[model samples]
Target chain A: MLLIPCPYCGLRDESEFVYGGPARALPDMDAQTPEAQHSLYRPINPRGPLRELWYHSGGCECWITLTRNTITHEFEDDLS
Target chain B: MGYSALSLMGHAFRGNTQWPTLIAAPDMRTIYDIVIIGGGGHGLATAHYLAKIYGLTNIAVCEAGWIGGGNTARNTTIVRSDYLLNGSFALKHFALKLWEDLTQDLDFNIMYEPRGYIDLAHSDGELEQFELRANAMRLRGADAQILDRSALKARIPLLSLDMDKRFPVSGALFQPAGGVVRHDAVAWGFARKASQAGIHIFQNCPVTGFDISDGVLQGVQTAKGHITCKQALISVAGESSAVAGLAGINLPLNSINVQACVTEPVKPALDAVVNYNVGLSYLSQTAKGEFVLGGATDGYASFARRGSFERIEDVLARAVQMFPFLSRLRLMRHWSGTADITADGNAIVGQTPVSGLMINSGWGYAGFKATPAVGHQLAELLATGILPDLIAPFALDRFALGAEQDDAGIGPYPWLH
Candidate 1:
């Protein structure tokens, strides 16, 4: 299991947390625009270092952003 | 000598020392009428169809590694068309039909076995969903039926029937035509045939970048050299995003790692492919008696072609739960492949926003089954410049138009899809 470093609860088991997907900033455009739709649906899925959001559902139940390497799965820092 | 009985006897009498190469190796040309950026199953099949059906011989298939080295050689090899969505149902069944006669058409034994498949349901709600899915498949002229506990047990007695267990087998959706095939043989067979038809198969040549001029794709810059082409098709499975990015075109795809494993060879214990829907594990015994199995994608997205130990442990727990006897069988080997999953579960096919650049990717876990149909439809799109009805529903513009076809019913999640 992944030893996820949650911002509120510190390190916890992966099962206790829910993956919130890639942490992308919401775009400031018309919701109907293709650019806006893509930003909302498409994922960057970067190969190297990634900043993603995770929810400590079983613990603090707060959304936490974590910068980690998707390839290595090593925890970098909690960006909450 | 031809592969006839007399030639075989003559060869045996002559000590059987000489043999001809199956396909010829040709050097890459500076230009081609069409360039297929991958030599995997789908890419090679696309070249085969383009040559045999569309009568287009001026084609080239480029591969960074050997043929079938990517997901084509790494998948679980299960072939079925029992999807709930209409588009998937159509495309997959078309592939199944093509697979039935692929050996005869290519003059190569791909070992396309029609041993059938069973998707187990562990609860009433799951069974109800299977009922709807099976009905939908049947309505689309695909073969699917719901098997009760007794029928399911009769088909595969090894499955655990204890309803009191954590995840019991209540019932299953059986597709009689679903089965497994030899994955690498499909790619090799297509490559051999396409090569014989005068299509160049370039190995160890990777497309490093695209040579686009004025927003139009002019050529591809490969590791060898730049090769101009009238049209280009990117059939690279997991590297769809990276390849498209070379042309400055972004696709609605995410590359994630999915893994599969196989057990040591033993006596045949399972006849049909068994899928535990609740546990997210699917398994089938190979013709050589090794049990090949796979689980769901990793929880997070990554381009690394390696799986985490946690996912493997979770999958093994579920596998042992479903098949108690499997606990004793030692795992022989395991490997992972990078799968390109889209926000919608369905694939993205057709011309991109840029002219002369076409794509046939975002297959995720379903690429092996959809290889034949993907090639046929993609060939049609490349040759005629018109999207075939079978693949029009999977256009790249669907995400922009907000007309996504999420077959898995999981919205906007690439890993889940």
Candidate 2:
């Protein structure tokens, strides 16, 4: 059980949150080009630490960003 | 030695001391006709077919660890061909047909138990959807039927019909030919056969980099030494993105962890594999009397092969709800595997952006069942350089062409798959 640190509501259980994938800027929703598909679908997923998004659905219901290790499951609540 | 009644008697007389090893770990060669990365079930099976069917002998299977150490040894070992999509159903059913002869073909027992599979539907709409899927599966020569409440009860006597008050049992999709196989035996069988065919099966040989020049793959750089090959197949399941990245190619893949567990051995009570489709939980009793259980993925991308406690709790809770007796059994083991999931919930096979390099990956949670067909088709593709119709729809560029094979209608979300 991951105690994800939600910025709005402090640390919460993983069941209280939904995992949004790798953190990236939103792409053009209307663009249908291959580049757009690559942007939306193909994410740069490293096996090491990286920034990701998590929705605090059961808590504050707010999206929070955090830098976490994919392999180790360690996290830092530095980012808001 | 070819295993037979004569060999068995001879071995028994010799106290089984003269039985040779299953496979050999040979020294890596400098060059080969083909190199298959990841000596899991898929890679070894491909090597076996490549040598036996295509008659290509100059091959080597490079494994990061020992054979069958990866997802090949981690899956729940459910084999079925009741997919809703035409292409997916065709590939799996073809694999199912191949599975029927796999024990004989590989000259080893894979423990292919066709003990039937049942998918429970909780609502009228889901039953209709299962009917559509049943028709699709039957069209592809797979035996599928829709069973109602009484039929499901009769098929699984231990199944509680109204256990979950929120979602009542409406019907189920039954596949008479679907069951489980011995997971480790699959990799071992392929490794033994491929090794006998003179394919080098190298253990602890991790491919560190790719030898590509001008968008053409020359070979691979391993921890032992650089091995040159004419053609290469990247069959690394969850590491598809990482390995392809070595060739400067980016694949639309995310490695997510999926988990399964088994209970302590008990008397054999369950006869068929039962899946509570509405709850997304499944279980099957092994010949050893252990109840193998599993549920959804962890719903995140991670390389950690450890599953979350939340998922374990949820799956067991659902399992106990369906079979009340399971609540009494204690869990014996639990583990997870990194699954290569694609956006559309379909596999990505065939050529990538890099020439002379192909991939057989993006099999999120269902690669174990498709081992034989993937081996056969990918061997054909590597030998002939032609995309077989069975896997052409799963090309890497399908997402761009609006040809996504989202069989579950879950849209383009890897986690949802």
Candidate 3:
């Protein structure tokens, strides 16, 4: 399980985590082309650093981006 | 490490080799070519491998409860091979490779996503320690990279890399081959395939005793009937020592109960599973959006599988610190399982004193991740009636020498053994 760093909660158990997939700076509402929205909604599952949303249900109950390695399940960053 | 080596251990690897000499004819009818004592994932996978790969058809999987309901399904569902030790190098990576190809191998959708996993360094001291881990992986041919504060932010823009922040993300050690899998699916998939391979699965049948009269295993005494088998494979996880007790041998094992919980479902949230190696806790969002969390196992081990509020409280404080988005989600269900913790955290594989009995036991926490390796190696043991080289070190005598296989040590935690 990934010990995600919640900005408000700190490092918590992965069970306390709620996976908020694909956190975007902005929702893709202003796409000029259909392909842009399609690409926005459907990202690839490649290996690398991924931006993830994790909730600290076991602690203060705040949401944050959990920079994670999909392969390692290790929390890279605790996005506040 | 196959059956031939059993002679050296004085039959500690295979319990009942000469079935005809030990069991009576009446009780022998229930016997199978291979009788697996635990219906957990390892047992089921072993059965599947023997039946599918080795064509060892006549096998029966006996479980104390519904199959796959043991420690096999009680984990946080995380899998990885990033370790800083040499002994753990082969075993952890073997499972990692198997996890990567599991979906195709099992012919079932395990939802295995090998995105990656990261380790946070909160202090310069911690960063120095992570460098050792990164170096270990490099020596073992595993990919691991150290990320600085700026590089960490570029990789993950939202991280609070500032040193001034509380619990700042000073740096990280990331490995892009670790991931998650549907724990139950691995069990079900193996069971389904094993059963189809002419292996009979008996549920709610607890093995009470081994019908051993004169230093030989005749068969097993269960609630239903006495099963006489030529070979027996025992994969009982939490109750491994309990099963061994039937043969009048006290195994050096501890049954530690671990508890975990899941939250009510919500919209899809987290993309990858995250963990804190120092805190000894982790949380990940399921595909259905429920938050699954677990921290330290119940402090001061007991046989009780039930959990306490203290452990939960510890996990919650850390959870909130990591991600503040969980205050809204309601805690739904919590469950527990007795995990068979060995003197060493590694598994104990090979034959036992009694003939015809082989064991796949003592996986402290990584049982779910090692399902494939256990199955594959166990099958080889069962077919040739011998122990495999891969699992040879995880034998019964390691306990006597005070050798513990405690890997999973990510940071510079104190040496447990």
Alpha-carbon local distance difference test for all models: 0.87, 0.89, 0.69
lDDT for each residue of candidate 2 in B1-417, tens digit (9 for 90 to 100): 668999999999999999999997688889999999999988998899999999998998889999889999999999999998888888988888998999999889999999999998889999999999999888767789999999988898988898447777898999999999999999999999999989998898889999888889898999889999879999999898898888888888888989999999999899899998754899999999999998999987889999789999989988987888999899999999999999898999999888989999999889999999999999999999988999998999888888999999988889889
Q: What TM-score does chain B of candidate 1 reach?
A: 0.97
Q: Which pairs of residues collide in candidate 2? A: none
Evaluate residue A69 in candidate 3 and report its C-alpha lDDT on the 0 to 100 scale. Answer: 52
| Top lDDT model | 2
Clashes (backbone N, CA, C under 3 Å), per candidate, total 0, 0, 77
Worst 10 residues of 3 chain B by lDDT: B19-28
- i-RMS, each model, one decimal: 1.8, 1.1, 20.0
In Å, residue A46's CA in model 1 sits off its true spot by 1.8
Tens-digit lDDT track of model 1 for B44-135: 99999999989998888889898878999999999999887788789999999999999888878899999998998888898999999999
Compute the lDDT of residue A46 as modeled in candidate 1: 76
lDDT (Cα, tens digit) per residue for candidate 3, span B1-417 = 112344546665566563221101122246677788888888888888898788887777778898658777888888877776665666778878888777777666678887666677778898888899899898878898898888776665433454555666678787888878889888777777776566788888898888876777778888778888777877887677668777875655555557788889977666556665556557777888887887766532334566556567667666655566676678898887766665446677887877767777777666787788888888888788667767877887664444555565322111121
Sort candidate 1 into its docking category: medium
- Which numbered prediction scores highest in TM-score against the true structure? 2
